[model samples]
Target: MTAPLSRRSLLGLVGAGAGAYLLGGCSGDDSSDDPDAPQTINWWHIQNTEPMLPVWAAMAEEYRGAHSNVTIEIQPLENEAFKAKLTTATQAGSPPDLFQSWGGGVLKQQLDAGLVKDLTDDVKPWVDGLLPASLQPYTIDGRIYGIPFDVGMVGFWYNKDLFSQAGITETPTTWAGVLDTVRKLKAAGTVPIALAGKDKWPVHNYWAYLAMRIGGLGALQQAAKDGNFDTPDFVAAGERLKELADLQPFQPGFLGAEYGSPDGQAAIMGNGGAAMELMGQWAPSMQASSSTSKKGIGDKLGFFTFPTVEGGKGNATDAFGGGNGFAVGKDAPAATIDFLKFLLTADNQRTSAKTGAVLPTVKEAVDAVTDANNKTVAETLASATGFQLYLDQAYPPAVGQQVNDSVAELVAGSKTPAQIVKDITQVAKSQ
Candidate 1:
């Protein structure tokens, strides 16, 4: 499975005044006679493990075979290591020809510095073949800067068997109903939620979704623009999260739980020790990998969109998630773009979906998703009214980390709702 979107670090890599120096040159031959020219495309991605690692290598080999004059150099790095290496490379005014990108605030920064190519005209012929929502994160100020290969959204991944045991006849549709569900699960002697408290990203999702429900999508963008997050709606989001925490809904010793470890959130749910977890489309694969039996709960797993908050302005269809994509570096060879197009063909996407590693972004490849749980997530995202990338990816690294830190303190009962918002606001302004 792909690593969490929040693992990327964008700090100091694309700061103010860095753009001017990075935008100095253009690379790649636009001439027609370049077909015979030998070229190399440096590519980097974070799928360092199977299914995707081999899948990507196979795709690259195929592309290379098709173009004997071109060579694809693939570097599969761990999540955090990729971010660190990319930071050093970009800051040195050089980036791989094609590299992994989450495509939000960080991509915007890179684009501002002219470190990446604008693919609007180049990809026009085939861009429509992909889902529009999946492209949302890569499109900045009316131009396309990246191409998405996978897409997904965050929602409640629950054990249907456990819900039945808790006597819940229907899935909750509102915040009150969710709380009631938690109460019922607890009363029935089940852990209502499994949280990876050691990883702040999972905790941030609760506050982020709450804010979206309370203030609507515009509130987040507006806050980022104004460098302020200490609004009434944001504070109320924290309070609502506090209400959920007050019920003691998490698994025992959850404050130190890791995300992918044997004793982590996914394992708890996969092993039937917990009723639910709020996670992305990749949850099932993660559950299976972390489980003792090496197989997840299978058909016993169910999913539902996050519940609406009473009197909130946001629509239920406003989705909160992000996905993976590829960005072209400023100095890449012309053949790099061709290799990218080749990698995203319908057949390639279908193969990727078959691996159950991605929620295919290619519209034609959607039917190839054999996993039941992922199919549901793809359907939900297809009809979404709006999309919000994870907060950690949607903002500058420092601001995003501040959100995680503040929310973690709130979850641990060390900070109040007002103080959380204030802390986040202070860091946002500094950015």
Candidate 2:
């Protein structure tokens, strides 16, 4: 599981800017290479945990076990460190054979660098049946470049026990209702929502959701693709986000909180002090790790899509997210593609889904989940009217950073809607 897409998306998007690269791999200096020497396929990922580390180990083991002639090496690093290393490796012309990446814009950067291989021929049948919206991010010039392993939507994950204690019976379904609910929750001595604004990424999610509610998915995507930040639609979205920020719905000093830490936010929600969390399916894993997991509070957690602004162009079901998946690198051995094809089969996806990792991208695997919570997430994703790729991935990197920074400043009362619009527009145009 990753940081909530809404907040983390922009950060991840603005993330891999030029940095000190870590260049370490097989020597390109080998003089007499046996043509039939087994290929070593390096798989890089940011799994800084025992639990996730084993998942990757299993993937590598299974892949290598089957291919016999191919050895898959797993390289795990801290998130930021991984990007820096990737930047270095690619520049050094000693990149990994395959690696983990978000399926859209992140992959596009590598694609442009001539670092990633076009997987269109191998993935066509699988890509063809994807949800209509899922196709756009992976398609660069009408060719597929990545396989989506986990695709899910972002939403409000709430503490139902807190809601019930506050006498609220149902999840709010519109923007007005969200405000009203937050007000009641705050007045009742519960934190209305948890926003880790210090991270900057969570703040980005607020802006993207605000924009989608005001302008709809198509409008937001259009602005992103055309690099038009000053459109009326974007301005309206900025204003709506500003309104949400002014409500002071987050815990005091939440603007100074570290987001990537699961314990901090989970503690607030699990204690029944926070009514809702604007997050993704990853919330479930956090819940599982909480003290409340045994007390039954974890089981009562509820989720709903971010509500649409009433009478706004967007539907309540419009969502924003991307699938995290594997991408084959340029010049990968034949066995590498075979390994990916095997691992991506419907059966393996179901196995991966059981880890509470994410909503599987394969339609059939998603249908096969028996867990109720996982199923709810699956159903919510499948039911979405459309999904906007996380804003960071939807736009250029610098533009994404400006949007993220604007939201953080706006929420802290250091900027206004007009100011944010101008700042983001300037960045977008410059990009």
Compose the digit string of candidate 1's lDDT tens values, residues 26-85. 224434347667677788886654456668878887777777776677777755567778
Candidate 1: which stretches are off by over 4 Å?
A: 1-35
Q: Give all TM-scores, in the order shown.
A: 0.88, 0.85
Best by TM-score: 1
Span of 10 residues, lowest total lDDT, candidate 1: 11-20
On lDDT, the candidate that comes out on top is 1
- Candidate 2 ranges beyond 4 A from true positions: 1-36, 78-81, 88-94, 124-135, 270-273, 290-296
lDDT of 2 by residue, 1-431 (tens): 12223322211211222321222233231222443356666667554333345565676676656545565666665444565687688788666777666555566778888888898887766665555455566778888887766666677888877888778888888877887888788778888887666666666777788778878877877776666667777777767766667788888779776544443454566555577777665556544433344232557777877877876888777667765666788877666676777767777777767766556666677665665665776787777777777776556556666777887888888987777878887877776
